[model samples]
Target chain A: MSDTSLTIRRFADLANPTRFLALSARLLPWICWLTAALFGLGLFYALTSAGDYQQGETVRIMYVHVPSAWLAMMTYMVMTLSALGTLVWRHPLADVSARAAMPIGAAFTALALVTGSLWGKPMWGAWWVWDARLTSFFILFLMYLGLIALNRALEDPTRAARLSAILILLGFINIPIIKFSVDWWNTLHQPASVLRMGGSAIDGEFLRPLLLMAGAFTCLFLALHLGAMRNEILRRRVAALRRQAARGALTAGGPA
Target chain B: MSLDAPHIGFVLASYGAALAIILGLILWVLLDGRARRAEIRALEAAGIRRRSDRPVDDARAAGPAP
Candidate 1:
C-alpha cells in the first residue's frame, strides 16, 4: 500500500471498538483522579483563600456560577463544531463527542441557572426575574435540551446527526445574545468584567482561583468526552456484531 | 476562613451543590461505560464459542442439510 493508504489504515484501526475501549480504560483513571484533584483545589481556594470585601461571603458563588456559565457557553461552541464535523467529514468520533458534550453542557447550564438564582436572590432581592441575561440563559438551557431531544428523536444515527446539526447551528444565536444582553439592555446584571475595557473588575485574590477552577472544569470535560466516545464506539460495534450473529443463526437454520 | 462573614452558608451551599452534581455525572459515565463494554465482551465470547463448536469437516457438509 502507498504511504497515504497506510496512514488511512492506521487511523481506521484506532476507530475499532476494542482499540478505543482499551484506550479509554487506560485513560479514564487519570481523568477521574485529575477531576477530583481539581475540584478539591477549587473548593479549598473558593472557601479559604479569599473572601469578598464587598459582597462578603456570598461572593463565593462566583466560583461556581461564573465557571459554569463560561463552560456552558464554551461547551455549546465546541458541540456546534463537533456537529459540523459530523455532517461534513462524517467523522465516526464526531457525533459521539458532540453527544457526550450535551449532558455536560446541560449540567453546566443548569448550574448557571441555579447559582444565578441563588446569587440573584441576595443581590436582586428576588429568587428570579425576567432580566435579559437571565432570560437568555434560560433560553440557552432550553437549547441544550432541544439539541439532546433532536438527537434522540430520530432512529437513524446519520439523520439524527444532520437534524441536530441544524438545530445547534440555529441555536448559536442564543450564545451571542446571552453574552451581549447585559450590555444591550442595561439590565441589573453587571456587564462583562473579565473581557472588558481596562481589566477585570474582580480582585486578583478571587480571580486566580476562579481561572484555575475554569481550567480544571474544562479538562474534566475533555476527559469525560473522550471516555464517552469510547463507550459509544463500543456500543455501535456490539450492535453490529449481534446483527451479524443473528443473520448467521438464521442462515444456519434455513433449508437450501 | 472568615467565620464572621455574612452569607457563609450560601457559599458553602453553592460549592456543595456543584460538587454533588459533578461527582454524580462522573459516576454515571464510568458505570455506563463499564456495563456496555461487559455486554460486548460477553457477546463476542458467545460468537467465538458458536464458531468453535462447528467441525471443520462439516463446513461443506452443513450446506443446507439436504
Candidate 2:
C-alpha cells in the first residue's frame, strides 16, 4: 500500500468485504441526510417556483421527468465504464458496483418512460409513440433488465461478472443513439433543449429548478449506489464462507 | 392558457411515480443492509464458537488416558 499503489489500495478497500462495510458505515448516514435535504429543496423549487409559460402548470412535471431521464442515460454510461474496469483491471469492486447499479438504473429508466408518457399525452395527443427517442430509451430499459437478469442467472460469481460486464458494454451503444436520435432523424420526441449547439431552449425561470433537481437526483444516486455496493460486498462474503464450510464438511466426512 | 389552466392530472401522476420509485429503492437498500449485517454477526458468532471448541477437542483426542 505504497504511494504508487494508492490506486490499487483504493481498489482493494472497495473490494474487501470488511473494509467496505466499515467505510459504508461512515458513508451511509451522511448520504442519507444529504439526499433528504437536496430532495426536499428540489421538490420545494419544483412545486413552488417552476411554472410553464406555454405548457403552464404541467411544466412542473419536467423537473422530475427530465432529471430522471438524464440520470437513466448517465447511469448506463457509468455501468459500462465499471464493466470495462472489471474486464481490464480485474477490479473486484467493479463487478459489484455495476451489479449494485442495475436496479437503481432500471427504476430511473422506468420512471423516465412513465413520466415522458404522461407529458406526451398532453403535448403530443398520444400516450405512446414509436418515435426514435422513445424507441431508443425503450432499448435502454431492456438493456438494464438484461444486465440484471444475466448477473442473477450465473452460479459462479466471476463468470457472472465477466458475462454481465460484456452485456453492459454492448448495451451501452444504445445510450448515444438515444441521445442523438432526435437530431439525426425526424422524431416526435423533442430535440435536446438543456443542451444544444447554441444554448438551452428553456428559460431562466424554469432552468434554475430543473438544474437543481438534476443535481439532487445525481447525489441521491451516488448515496444509494454506495449503500447497495456495501450490501453486495457483504452478501458475497457470506456466500463464499458458506461454500467453504460446505466443502469442509464434505471433506471431513470422507472415507479414511 | 393561464398559468393555472391546463391538464393537472399528468403532473400529479409524474410526481407520484417518482416518489414511488425513489422510496421503494430506499426501503430495499435499508432492509438489505439490516439483513446482511445480521447474517454477518451470526456467521462471526458461529466461527468463534467453532474455534473455541477446536482446542478442547484436540486436547481430548491427545489425552494420556489408556
Candidate 3:
C-alpha cells in the first residue's frame, strides 16, 4: 500500500474503541510519571528562582497562573479539533476525547480565574475587573460549563455528542478574543508576553521556571485526559453489556 | 520563596487554591478510572463478554447470541 493510505489505515484503526482503550492504558502510566517528575522540578524551580525586580515575590504567582491560563485555552483548542473529528470525520473517539476534556478544561479555566484574581488583588488593586481579557476568560469558563450541561441534558448519546460538538465549534470564537483582548482594548490585564509576535518580554530568570511549569501542566492535562477517556470507554462497554443482558432475558422469556 | 514577603498571603493563597484544584482533579480522574476498571472486571467475571474478547468468527454475532 502507498504511504498515504497506510497512514490513513492506521488512523482509522484507532476508531475502534477497544484499540484506543488498550493504547491509552499503555500510555497513561508513563504520562503520569512524567507529569509527577515535571511538576516536582517545576515547583522547585519556580520557588527557588530570583524575585522579579519590578513585581517582586508576587511575580511567583505567574508561574502557576500563566500555565493554567495557557492550558485552559489549549484544552479548548484540543476540544475544537476533536469536535471537527466528530462532525466531519465521524470518528467515534473524537466525541469521547472532547467529552473527556471538558471537565479538565473547566478546572483549568477556574484555576486561571481564581489565581488571576489572587494575583490581581495585589497587582491591579482589585479582586476582579471587567476588562475585555478577564471577561472573555470568564465567558470561556461559562462555555465549558454549558458544554458539560448540554451533554448531560441530552439523553441520546449520539445526538448529545453532535450538539456538543457544534457548541464547541461555535464557542471557539472566544479563544482568539481571550488571546488578543489585551491588544484590542486597553485593559488592566497584561498583553501577551510569552507568545507575542515580536518576542517574549519576560526575563530569562522568570521564563525558565514558567516554561517548566507549563510543561508540567501540559503533562498533567494529558495524563488526566487519557484516564478520563479510558473510563468513558469502559462506561460505554458496561452500558452495552447491560443492554445485551436485558435483551437476552426478554428474548429467552418469549413464547417458549 | 520567602514567606515573610509583604503580600505573601496573596501569593500563598494563589498557590494554595491552584494546588487544591489541580490535585483534586487528578485524584478524581484516578479514582474514576479505577472504579470503572473494577466494574468492567466484575461484568466480565459474570460472563458478559467484551466485544474485543469475542472470537473473530463471532464477528457477526449480536446480543450475546441468546
Candidate 4:
C-alpha cells in the first residue's frame, strides 16, 4: 500500500472509540504527570524571574495571561479541524473531539479575560475596556459558551454534531480577528510580542518564563482534552446501552 | 504573592484566579469520567450489556441490534 493509504488506515484505527479509550487510558497518566511537572517548573521560574523595569511584579501575570489567551485560540483551531472531520470526512470521533474541547476552550478564554482584566487595572488603569482585542476576545468567549449550550440543547447526536460542526466553522472567523485586533485598531491591549512577524520582542528574562508557562499550559490542555474525549466516548456508550436495553425490554415484555 | 512585592494584590489575584480555574477544570473532568463509568457499570449490573461486551458470535447472532 502507498504511504497515504497506510497513514489513512492508522487514522481510521484511532477513529474507533474503543481503541481511543484504550490509547487514552494508557497515555493519560504520563500526560498528567508531565503536565504537573511542567506547571511546577514553569510557576517556579515565573515567580523567581527578575522584575520588569516598568511593569514590576505584575508582569508575572503575563506568564498566565498570555498562555491562556494562546490556548483559547489554539483549542478553537483544534475544534475547527474536528469540525472538518465531522463535515467532510465524516469521522465518528470528530464531533466528540469538538464537543469535548468546548468547555476547555471556554475555560482558557475566561482565564485570559480575567487575567487580562487584572493586568489591565494597574497597567491600563481600567478594569475593563472596549478595545478591539479585548472586545474580540470577549466575543470569542461568548462563542464558546454558545456552542457548548447548543451541544447540550440538541437531543439527537447526529443532528447536534452536524449543526455544531457548521457553527464551529462559522465561529472560526473570530480567531484571526482576535489575533489582529490590536493591530487593526488603537487598542489598550498591546500588539503581538511573542508571536510576531520578525521574532519575539520580549527580553530574555521575561520571555523564558513566559515560554515555559506556555508549554505547561499546552500540556495541561492536551491532558484535559484527552480525558474529555474519553468521557465523551463513555457517554455515547452509556446512551447506546440505554437504547439497547429499551429495545430489549419492548421485545421481551419487561422493564429495562 | 510575595508580601514585600509591589502590586502584590494584582499578581496574587491573577495567579489565584488561574489556579482556581485550572483546579475546577481538572476536578470537573475527573468527576465527569467517574460519573459516566458509574453509569455504565450500573447499566451492566442491571443486565444491560453493551453489544461490544458480548462475545463476537453473540454479537453476530444479535445482528443489527441497536
Question: Clash totals for all models, in order?
Answer: 0, 0, 0, 0
TM-score of each: 0.85, 0.88, 0.95, 0.96
Provide the global lDDT of candidate 3 against the true structure: 0.91
**Which ten residues in a row are the worst by lDDT in model 3 chain A?**
A243-252
Residue A106, model 4: Cα distance from true site in angstroms:
0.7
Deviation in angstroms for A171 in model 4?
0.8
For model 1, the DockQ equals: 0.46
Task: Tell me the TM-score of model 2.
Answer: 0.88
Q: Give the winner by TM-score: 1 or 4.
A: 4
Query: Mind giving the per-residue lDDT tens digits that candidate 1 earns over A1-256?
Result: 9999999988777655556667777987887788778878887787777666678788889989999999999999998888787788776777877888888899889988888888887777888989899999999999899888888888898888778877888889899999999989968889998878898887888887788788788878878778767777767666766876787788889966
The reply for model 4, stretches above 4 Å from the true place, is A254-256, B64-66
DockQ of each candidate relative to the true complex:
0.46, 0.43, 0.78, 0.78
Model 4, position A156, has a per-residue lDDT of: 94
Off by over 4 Å in 1: A1-27, B48-66
lDDT of 3 by residue, A1-256 (tens): 9999999999999999878878888998899899999999999989999988777899999999999999999999999999999999999999999999999999999999999999898888999999899999999999999999999899899999999999999999999999989999999998888988889998898999999999999999999898888888888887888887786688789966
The per-candidate TM-score of the B chain, in the order shown, comes to 0.66, 0.61, 0.77, 0.81
lDDT of 4 at A248: 82
Please give the C-alpha DockQ score of model 2.
0.43
